[model samples]
Target chain A: MVTSAAPRHAAPPVHAGPARMTATPPPIPTLLDSDVVRPAPPASRAIKAQVENFSFFYSTVQALADVSLPFRERAITALIGPSGCGKTTLLRCFNRMHDLYPGNRYVGRILLHPDNLNIVAREVDPISLRMRISMVFQKPNPFPKSIFENVAYGLRLRGIRSRSELEGRIQVALEDAALWGEVKDRLRKPAYDLSGGQQQRLCIARALANEPEVLLLDEPTSALDPIATSRIEDLIVELKERVTIAIVTHNMQQAARISDYTAFMYLGKLIEYGATAEVFQNPKCKETEDYVTGRFG
Target chain B: MSTILSDNPVSGGIAGSRNGGLLPPLRSRSLLGRLAERFIESGLLLAAAFSVLITGGIVFVLVSESLPFFRHVSAREFLTDRLWTPMFADPHHGIMPLVAGTLTTTAVALLVAMPVGTLIAVWLSEFAPSRLREVLKPALELLAAVPTVVYGYFAVDFVTPALQAFIPDLPTFNMLGPGIVMGVMIIPYVSSLSEDAIRAVPMLLREGSYALGAGKFTTAMRVVYPAAFSGIASAYVLAISRAVGETMIVAIAAGQQPNLSFNPLDPAATITAFIVQVSLGDLPHGSIGYQSIFAAGVTLFVMTLGFNIIGAVMRRRYRQAY
Candidate 1:
């Protein structure tokens, strides 16, 4: 069976026929200029989280350092970094959960709608901004509620009062999260009764109920076992067709496995941003190369 | 975060190494330590037992006092009878009027509390930011801890007059004044309990609602409220119990007369208030007068206990299973 080779940013082989062994290559630059691969740029600004000069600070501590990048619309963009490198912090900024904690400060523009550029101002209404960008945390956090109610939660908030309408929506959202078949018969059952994986899926279903335009996943599969992680990975693909996604993953394999684009950050700075294969194989920046190649955290 | 590795000579390390190897090893039991530990454990056990025992004793006493009334007067007549003339020589001590009065006050209090308390909870939990929420939560709960007598005093001195200005013929001791005051007293019970429940809802749920383009108020009212309903329902029950069992406020603000009227503007009496009226200062024990107070006490106890049971069961059935 022919499979599409791993998407761009994969390092092309450096062979001996090119005299690469004899001629010690200079410390190679990482970034592959866009012009090298495709001649002309696309017409539309097609991306979900367009961060322009985005810098975030928690009180006096700087978290994200002037990170400028765009997450392709409906295409998964993985922010890969080690612990405390600000991937989660950056992800939280999209949905504004950081706003809940005091002393969270930021200076930048994060654009959800590339078409209209609605969030150019730093003082955008976070509630409305957050509504367009749904988030799933690292741990599965289904409310202490029934499975049906968990999925129905966001839909109900939208004033979908009719039981039939709610049920229909709950079914669709659960199905979208790939959790319906297992929980379909037990909608009234408590959410905690489900397996860890199922609970994560139910949380995902709850998020989906609101029909968000962008989904932010902060190490969503970190706590799940491999099988559940695989299921979530598959669901991410299925979800992408409808809404944009920004995923923060520490696992390099996860980034390689699922994302269309990958951004590598180190010490709270976006070191490299490009197609996943290009970023992984031929990181233009020494920092990105060192980080991605396992030479440095 | 860390332990120090000191080069102490004998006593500090292994009880002697840091202190020139002078002291003998101490066993796990020292006379003082053993005694203190035992005392502490027993104290905790006794404290916990007393907590349970106190609750049990109250239930036992209420039932013991109520049993004779139930035996002398059939449960059906006590529950269904229309008149409440406990002091009357002919003995027309029907409890229907008292129950009706209790229900009227409870319903009106609920009507007042559910909306205002829920709104305050929503505002405190969802709308208000950290600085304001910290300031407001305690201030709101302070409403609950205010002495009941003080609330009663206000009901008579402040609320009754204010109410009369609107309703010209309002009675000085009317259910409306007490019911409204009771609602105010119980607001903290509803607001704080509900605010906690709403706040407990995972941030993810709120985020999902927000992402759907629904407003904050919409998300809180629709999403968080229903998710926290079981807890909120429990809170409501708690508030109702508080309203129904309140004695001083209703006794002073609402009239002592048990004239079976459902109208809020008219004077009516609740079971607890009637107990206060009957049990005031000099009521001879073993007499029916004394027994009537016990009977009223039993009724109040039963109603409050029922609310607690319902609240607990509802919470258990509809808990945050996940």
Candidate 2:
């Protein structure tokens, strides 16, 4: 299942030209300087999930306000903004993670495609919905279990009792995560015995074990060193070919380098949504331009 | 100072100070401050060392006193022969009966405490709402605050009578009543410590489980329990130690006859109860009968020490697993 290794620090191939020069020093782009309109994702790709006028409240405080966005099929959508800009909040709403806490309310629907199920509906079970939508958290959080068992956890949850089937699926998931080679000899070792980067990959392998249709990543490398972060970035890029991916990241260059689409949120509002190249190089929204150009965040 | 500043890039900027000294030469501590610091350090050290000294002294006393008793009774008889009638005209000093009694009562207490305490901990840590947990924890701890003497009476006066209704053959001073009461008394120690351990597990782990679609029960059993295993193991050990060394409940409720029987329905005397029974009477200070209590004390000490070693090893193993 291995593909040719992408170059380290590779920018999205579609947008790898002069347009991507905004990352380096240039005359600081002012809010009024750019007039380029937001370029939408091409109509050829199908929408995998859509957030329709979604708003969220933690008791009385609204963390997300009337946010609407689309996750394109088998594509990486990056959510970027300042801290508490509701990027993570928006990503969590996809799998009904807020349901874990009381007094957290969702006012609009997150419609999953194919089945078109309203994931946030009260009648819908968050546990069952989470089966099809898995998540990798900000910190690497492999269970206090053997590496093999960590990968097999979600499979066992789905009642995969056959030992051979579990081993096969776990192998594929670990291979897909690029971790099987490093950990193959000692699958019975504890997950924490691995380094931080490997632990995060084990988490990804754990999420992948479910073969979920959608995968949510919340700052999956914020805790790692640059080298480990780059490895996870490479893995995320490869993962988008199989599962619809949405990521929340503070690293703007990272968002630019990996994401197919970019959504900029500010103060619980979606400031802009478009192709990653347009968002970084030529944002339609002034806040998006100011934030993306490192003028302010 | 100039040499130091020239060698360090960060400190070079401060080299132009009027005095050649770097940062005012860090004001020397006053004599009074130095004295107070020394006093506090030694005072804290003494406080810590005080407990260790007391424990060492107790072990010395138990060993010295028990040496006389072993000279009077052969070690093989003390270990093997079941009869333990030290005050009889023809006394039999076999310690087997007391050891058997202690083990039986402790086993019964653990049978009741381990499972019940663990379930209570899981409920408090994973299932209970925060407000409920806040109110419930301190209230549950009140179980431990109730004096052991009260638990002893409750075992004899209330529990034994209640059990008698169903099992008419159970004697009034049967070990079963006191064992269950001791377990109830120890519930707080186990549940409270286990709850703290389970609660201390980082939220990230639970989120990982939930993201995998595991329900609250599954998350608690599969993820939280194993993650908190070391802490829970220590809690269990503490409960075992508490039950083994427990004095009042068994002394009052379980009959003080050193009967070598494992049956819970039979009256028995644990090591603690035997000690209490002997210490109450006036035997010559250095006599074998009086010295037997020290021998019993040593056995109890050994049992608790073994348990603590097992707990420490378990805690290290699970901590390393993570």
Candidate 3:
């Protein structure tokens, strides 16, 4: 659909012919200059998951209003906005994380294709769905069990009780999260004994053990130190080769460094979304530009 | 710093000391004020020591009173004999029957209270909604505030009659009746303390479990329960101690007979009940019968003290730092 409201950042690809340059690309209007109008790019990109005209409410308060975006497969999509802008809310909708509470209502459809399941459908069981689309929390929350048992929890839920199989899978998941070397000698030790960075890595390993199709991270490094944050950022980059990732982060540089696509939300609305490089360097909406340029949140 | 303190009482002592690199001196105070401060400090210390002094006094009394009874009757016979007829014409003051009676009633109370109390705690902390929890928690705790004599009456009038229908030969006053009523009395302690401990576990842990695809039952039983195990165990120990020290219910409903039997339906007299029996009757204050209560009191104190210590150690050992 050729809606004129395509994110100003994702302008239609420049025509190859030099003759079209003379027409002058439609000028973006400054706040002072209101007469200019520009056509936005078509929202017809191939997508792994499509949030179609979706809105959400917590009791009577609307948290997201008719947000629509494409989550591409095998790539990192970062949801960035100021606090209470509904970025985390949109990320949680991907895995139905809000199902934990009562009176949290989802309206419209979040159609996840290939699997062809609308995640918000009443018939869909949240427990089984969570196995396919797992989540990581803001703070590191490893179980009080041993590191081995913490990593084995998800696998055990699926009934993988054989010793050799559990050991092999635990090793592989820990290695994938880049934590096996530090914790290999202490697999039987309680998880709380690990350093903060190591604990966060252990949580990542726990999620990896399940091999979910999509991984949702909700500000996974907010409680971490700088060194731990960088390590988690690197892990997120490496993980996208196997699993689709949807992350909610307030760190713009981290998003610019790691994500392929970025969706900027404001006041529960998708203000702009496109390739991260383009959205950062050249935002289409005035509000998007202001947020990326650090003028205002 | 001295000048600042004398000039400005509004500036906290900390700020003056921090900036000046010297503590505000108290020596400049009037002699009378200094003396008053010293007196106050000692008064507070004495108040703290008063509890220790009382504990020591109880030990001294028990040991001195019990020493005379042991002189008349050997410690070996008093401890090993199955019969405990201290007031009889040919008295054979064995402590076995009273000890057995205390254990039987305590075991019955724990058997009835542990599972039911823990289940109620789990339901309150994990399953109940906030609105329901607000109403139910205080209502359940109100059971503990009911006087023990009232529980005794209820046990005799209500519980024994109920049991008589099924057993057909239930006694009027038996260990089972008081034990069941005592279990009901102890339920609130177990449930309230366990609920507090379970609720103390961080919500982050529950969210972690849910994020890992665990259902609510798995989250509650596997994760939350283990995290709160020490607290729940301590609650159990405290509840058991409360049951052992319980007096009025057992004295009224568990009979005055000192039978050395494990049969809960049979009439028995717990240590507390025997102490009550001896204290209420007319006997010379210094007689062997009167002195026997002190020995029993010492045993009861040691048992309850052991339980409280165990509870304290468990609380320390399993405390989660987070």
Best by lDDT: 2
lDDT of 2 by residue, A1-297 (tens): 001222234433443444344454434453322322223446547889999999999999999999888899978999999989999998888888888889999999899999899988999999998999999999899899999999999999999999999999999999999999999999999998999999999999999999999999998988887778877887898888899999998877677677889999999999999888677776888798878766776
* lDDT tens readout by residue for model 1, A79-178: 9877788998888887777766678887887776655554535567776665567788888876656788777766665678998999888888989999
TM-score against truth, every candidate:
0.79, 0.91, 0.84
Q: Across residues B1-322, which tens digit of lDDT does each residue of candidate 1 receive?
A: 0233233333244655656668764344458987999999999999889989998998788778877767677767777778888677777677878877898888888888999999999899888987999999899889988999999999999999998999999989888888888898889899999999988888866655565455767778767887888889988998988888878988888888886788888888888888888778476776765777777877777788898999899887766642
Each candidate's fnat:
0.43, 0.89, 0.66
- Give the per-residue lDDT digits (tens) of candidate 3, residues B6-57: 6655556557567685665333566898799999999999999999999999
What's model 1's lDDT at B170? Answer: 93
Error of 1 at A88 (Å): 2.4
Tell me the tens digit of each residue's lDDT in model 2 across B279-315.
9988878878888888888888998999999999999
Of 2 and 3, the candidate ahead on TM-score is: 2
Model 2 scores a TM of 0.91
